[model samples]
Target: MTKQRSDEPEVKPFKGPAGGWGSVRSLADILPREHLGPEAYRELARQNKPDGFMCVSCAWPKPADHHPAEFCEEGAKATAWELTRLRTTPEFFAEHTLAELRGWKDYDLEQHGRLTHPMRYDPGTDKYVAVSWDEAFDEIGRELKRLDPKSVVFYSSGRTSLEASYMYGLMARMFGNQNLPDSSNMCHESTSVGLKAALGVPVGTTQLKDFKETDAIFFFGQNVGSNAPRMLHDLRDCRKRGVEIVTFNPLKERGLERFTDPQNPVEMATLKETAISTQYHQLRAGSDIAAIIGICKFLIDWDDLAKADDDLPVLDHDFIAQHTKGFDEFAAAIRKTEWADIERETGLAREELEASARIYAKAKAVMAIYGMGITQHVKGVESVRMIVNLLLLRGNVGKPGAGPTPVRGHSNVQGQRTVGITEKTELVPVEKLEAQYGFKAPREKGLDTVETCRGVIDGSVRAVVGLGGNFLRAVPETGAMEEAWPRLDVSVQIATKLNRNHLFAGRVTYLLPCLGRIEQDVQASGPQAVSTEDSTSCIHGSRGKAKPASPYLLSEPAIVAGIAKRILDDNPKVDWDGWVADYSTIRDAIEDTYPAIFKDYNKRLFTPGGVWKGNKASERIWETPSKRAEFLTPGEISATGFKDADGRYRLITLRSNDQFNTTIYGYHDRFRGIKGTRDVLLMHETDIAAAGLAEGQIVALESDAGDGVQRRRDGMIVTPYDIPRGCLGAYYPEANVLIPVEHHAEKSHVPAAKSVPVRIRP
Candidate 1:
């Protein structure tokens, strides 16, 4: 919405590796700008500590032996940003009208600082006026009572803790709606769908310790440096142990190229960086399925040739026969796949796939790591299953340092799902919940993020209660949401900072400020500590040391309890007041619901470095219908059948170095050499030539989703870069407008943000 003040962004080649002094300088710059004092730095140091708060940035597991300063650059930025000395009070809202605030940039809105009090939208004045918490809750309760429970959508952000998410899910179900759409639906739903179908579990099989023993690692479409910087330390150690790291992505990511551990004094002082990836392959966008299938076909051919000579075959026949099903069909499918088709689909040579396969076959233990790049596609579920299939081929699932790992984005996103944040009632199981909590849970399947948006647009959804995320900005079809959100009967946002979503107020809107991760949450009994589960399934306690940003700010659990108490009124089955007083009761309830995984959840939560909830696949135990690991045969390599015209390109939405999800930290993307702008599109030189466009030329991107809907985003400057020939990259939230809401993954229903077909217009 805001035009660039300058002509174009300053783009230069960045030669240094990721992290090192660059990260150090970033942390220093953020602290001063955010006005974070020495106390804030001390609080940041407590991140990932045994009795400290969890970093709100990424979900990379905390190491057992962590340094005094275990946080990353992005973690430090998030800390300083959340604990900033600025505040947005009633006076600030009074000065800026809702109409005026709409013109401000996302970064500008967040920079105004934390929301200090409960505020309600005044449509008459077009300004938000401070309201009492009780009044806000009463109004929300009144609206919920008037509307049918099925008509209300409850959305949760990934940053919410397990206790809060559990309470939120329970409240929604008790209110008779399972319309619980979370941030995971937009990112890792594919992982859940594919992994469940293949490995009998939705989570990864390996832990953080497996990285040290891994012989080789295949990174498919994951940008670890900008996202999970803490993972760089593990990768560096793996490299030191002679582990081969292969990366496949559309663009050459600096994190995969090289990394300098900021914690290592020698490397920081000498400006030396560790070479991370042993091999980097620039595959075409949406070609992951094809390239992975190529690897499988190569391995199959190698095994066939070796078996013909009566020599030891490359296939792990003993493990396959003993622990898996459908391998014969899977192998047959791979054998029929042609190399010519693989090359055409992947934009890679036959030699490249074979070379990578050779490394993979030779490695005794392997781990495959991926992110949204692998999961945010039309065939994302199939792509994830292919990764699992590759691992299963070599008996990697039950072995040390071997398995599939889907690197999650949000800090507690995985934990949120583990604690019962889902649209499907079967995940929570109404019978078990009713037995444990004495309340009847909703049995019907509910709407996901995309469906929720559609429900809002169709007037079926009347009220929306957001726990912590900027849903309007994060989801696809931003323009459509901007139009539909105002039509809702009621909307409530329980957040720490002001985001664009707060501006998308319904007829009656309320903003309830909540405590940040670093703030002290004093309950009725005493100060409370919430728990978060990382990507590795390690459950740890996070106790905030800093004071609340504002006196009026309530803890997330308290906010959820307050709303639930008002809506449920004298319901004896739900003990909202008791759980809010002490979080351990909530943990006990979680243990009662999922006794197998969370056994002794309270006692183990206080243990040093927390406890690991064992994964079934890692122990050679599958819970599938066949009672064994299933080798799913994908129907075709090019399952999406997304064909780009001669001049069109496949555009993938990505976060910048200075941002996380929809929260903009700044306009610069240091890793990609972008500065002072989020309106530029990173394109290949050949693509620019074919499109008859030059670098710095402003253009519009029109979606070719083929659903007969015209979706376009204009005022984006094209920057020729090292991306693949037919692929383009742009910052998210800004580029989300080009992604059609209906164009989503099949089983998971996650929007195909990373594989949208688009045509450039000058």
Candidate 2:
């Protein structure tokens, strides 16, 4: 790690914090809340077609025609963020030095407003100056021409349109480097890698319609309310139909317990909230495998007992026999897992596990939903595999409302990956690219976010081109990632807002501001519409309504076009200008490249509500060699509980209600009584009592592994809660300081945020 001064502001812990329902009420006043005037947003939010742009914040599926107030809290924030009246002109850039700008907070940087022009970083003056698009593009092209393809990493964000993402993929492929690391690596990479390895495809099995028909909903390690508020309506509707909703997490998040739908007029008028979960189980961090396995074992035992009494159907034996493999070996593994070990690890008694399994068994249709909590661990891939395995036991994959659902964080993350944003997978097949583009593209796999950072640190990486994302703050090893950015020969950013990543300048760095998703895209051809894929593999056209924040600002597609034209000048075969002139051509290219998935992409996007790229094998079609979903015989599973005085307590990192990924919207966490700050830990009362710490006690948490990473975050107020006895929870980015870059999932490179081992001290 590089030795450097920690210039980041030190946020003090909140003293005498209020607790309970009152805290949520108090938050309404502190957190930034302002409704768009009816006149200003009326035309924008109309259900009638103006443009078909989806919200760029979350992956919550939206109906083709939803009412005006159909948007949820997070959706409102995301939509409002794009439609913000703020602007960051060249004058603003001229005023703030790179070093001085680096000192601004994440929220402050975002609040400074959107970047309005193409600018180049002048290290000599330490400030950015406006530059012509051609000059910036030529500079980037010169660097690309000088360096080996492997020396450059092309990073992307989820907010990019499908056409832009596809073109960007083509650009990197043309450059002969597959180093296309995007935002996916940080959040749902495990789901994509793990689920695909286990089931031959990577996507959620359930469609939005499934929510209405589901008999039971089991959310594992996901907080739907804060993350995807519209999901509350589905859960609330399910509850009305007497459907059982259960939650399993390390912390008793308010989102999973109860939610007041702000969109509902009657509900909001009465200030009434609906209960989301009937039974909330607090599984200790890192204990998910044990708990899930224990439930499977209990179901097996219950089946045997039911068979003796002529009351069978304890499990879906027929589905297990017909559509899955290795169940018997997996059953044997579950039986061998000791009850005491299960309790010691999962912090759940056999009865509790049995109770949950019995309810699961009784339900006709069930959907097991999860998020980063299940994917951000060393065993994250295995954890996802296990969830699918459990679902397969009951033949949950194909049936409506009964399957594996990994709730994606960003709105276009799944879509971006599906289109092109990948370092490992090829966007266009090599043979196809060779034939169509007339270039012998590189077949070697590219570097993801982790590999890119490592490549830069080791001096292999020379340049980075970002397409709308904060790369440094988003990835782990903050120090390493930050240091490596400045060493790059050229850093190009095509973005909408000013972020921390812009401050990490290079020898020849350029910031090219692009149009937001809500802004209409006008090009050389005409006004264009871009497409994006959702979590369930649904592709739809997104058209922007608002005018560009600046006349000079370009849409993502045009920005990529400008760079590609300058770089691919000598290559007569490539038609960069034509692709950017009309987005439909890019869609045609996508169709030509990925025929199986994007077949007739141009025609289908215009179809009512777009088309769904069927996850055929993900529906339990079983594309594996055995032609069945294989149930792995997992090894003995146990977690190190707090009882082990050698200093081990499961630590879980979380995102705040006001924050989304590395982008901090505000400092207030209303539900937790945290205001203008983000430093605090929620611990179990028993653990606090045992540690001799009182409520509001400031404590230092040290990692048990002694990795020498900032092992301890001091001056944190220890608040007692109903969290699992052996685990603790804290907000990320701030708590990200505690996670080591190497401490990641074995298969997926995802940071082990949920299962970090630590000890708390007063």
TM-score of each: 0.98, 0.92
lDDT of each: 0.89, 0.75
As for candidate 2, its clashing pairs are 53-543
lDDT by residue (tens digit), candidate 1, 1-762 = 122233347898877789988888788777887877788978987988887888898988777788879899888889998999988899999999888989888898898889999999999999999999999989988888899999999999999999999999988888998899998999999999999989888999888889878999999989998899889988998999899999999888889989998888899889998999998999988899889899999999889999998988898999999999999999999899888989988899989998999999999999999999998999999999999999999998989999999999999999988888999866776788888767777788988999998998889999999999999999998888889999999999999988999997899999999999888889888989899999988898888989888999989998999889878757676688899999999999899888998998888775665688888889989989998899989887853548757766788898888998898888668888888788888898987887778888988999887788888889998898998888889889889889888888988999999888888876
**What digit string (tens of lDDT, one per residue) describes model 2 on residues 555-622?**
78878888887776467666777877888988988888789888888777755545788886645686
**Runs in model 1 lying further than 4 Å from the true structure:** 1-8, 639-641
Q: What is the Cα-based lDDT of residue 608 in candidate 1?
A: 68
Model 2 residue runs over 4 Å out of place are: 1-40, 43-51, 308-311, 426-428, 606-608, 636-645, 692-705, 708-715, 759-762
Alpha-carbon RMSD, each predicted model? 1.6, 4.4
User: Which candidate number has the best TM-score?
Assistant: 1
Error at 590, model 2, angstroms = 1.4
